[model samples]
Target: MATSKSKTSLREDLTCAICFELFKEPVMLGCMHHFCRRCIVSYWKSVRSPVTCPQCRQEFPNKCCFQTNYLVANLVEKVRASSSPASVKYLEKELNDCLESQCSMKDAYISMIRKDKDKMEKIKKTGAELQGRVHNDFQALHHFLQVEEEAMIEELKREQEEMLQGLERHLEALQVAIRDVEKNINILRQTAGSTDQSVLVELPKLNSRPISIDI
Candidate 1:
């Protein structure tokens, strides 16, 4: 018997069409193509409604096209686990690259969060300052209104007192005029009772002159 020639090729035995990464959850599509289930599912989610196979671009049934092949998935995991040190080193390099990229993403996320917090703090400070200004303005307006109201009340009191004094003066003058008229009527009544025609004649002249009281 002759020595066996190398028949298997590394390219055909271990490779993925898309992403070129070691398959994690390998799924066999109807078109005889292989891909990680999660990756293909994400690819299908980008499309509108109807789904299709990522490899051959062949249209698939709605919602139920993506299938999981546990056999292939287990085989890929076992092969990667049992790989040589050189193969593991290459995979480790890719994983380290991914870890570095994740570190950058983490930095970006942290920076964005810090910026958002700073913006929020600024907004809070501005709101507090504006509130203080509004409060001061309201207090000033209240003080002004209070002073004006007090002034108006004082003026009204003064005017009311003046009106009351004027009204009392008018009442006193009216009472004096009424008393004088009553006295004149009494004098006329007395003269009528007496048989004195002279006094009656003098009464007409007294009534024509203005009354004067010296008190």
Candidate 2:
């Protein structure tokens, strides 16, 4: 009798139900089934009605039934490793490569973060300087207004003093004219003591001359 060769089955654990390929951006459905995110998205776009499970035939009222299944994907890899050591070793090598790439990405991200911090500090300092300048401008404007107000008050006071002085001068002139009239009346009274009553009455009818001054 001829010895039979044992058949090695390929891994169906990482295979996606939707695309029958390795699950990239794998997402879980409400029916607990795994599918690639792009694959499920494409299926959703093609469907006329609400999305449902292809395996269990469970119908969902809406197409928003898919979600990320990171834990399940990790579990699937673990299960595959228990069955096949070669697949596990291959997956570990790929995982190491991914880690190395991520390490480089982290270094770039750290440098970018440092740059952002420096930029943020510069912005904060500039903002503070702007605030100080704004405050100084307001203070300067306030002082200017105060000075203008005081100047206006001084001008008003000067005008009032000038008006009062003019009124005093006018009053003094009126007083002098009244005194001269009284003196003339006294002189007429004395002159009338030796004159007749008819001449005294005629003295009041005489025109008085106005006094004038240069200053």
- Please tell me which predicted candidate would have the highest TM-score against the true structure: 1
What 10-residue stretch in candidate 2 is worst by lDDT?
Answer: 1-10
Reference-based lDDT, each prediction: 0.73, 0.76
Question: On residues 1-215, what C-alpha lDDT tens digit does candidate 2 reach at each position?
Answer: 12111112224666787777667777888888878888887887887775777677788878788788887667555555655778767867988999999999999999999999999999999999999999999999999999999999999999999989977887788787888788888877787786556655455543354655532
Q: Model 2: how far is 37 from its true place, Å?
A: 44
How far is 172's C-alpha from truth in model 2 (Å)?
1.0
lDDT of 1: 0.73
Best by lDDT: 2
lDDT of 1 by residue, 1-215 (tens): 12112212332444566667667677777776778777777777777856667667787777466578887777676666647698778877987999999999999999999999999999999999999999999999999999999999999999999988977777776677788778778877877788867655555423333434422
Residue 14 accuracy (lDDT) in model 2? 66
Q: Model 2 Cα displacement at 192 (Å)?
A: 8.5
- Every model's TM-score: 0.53, 0.46
Clashes of each: 0, 0
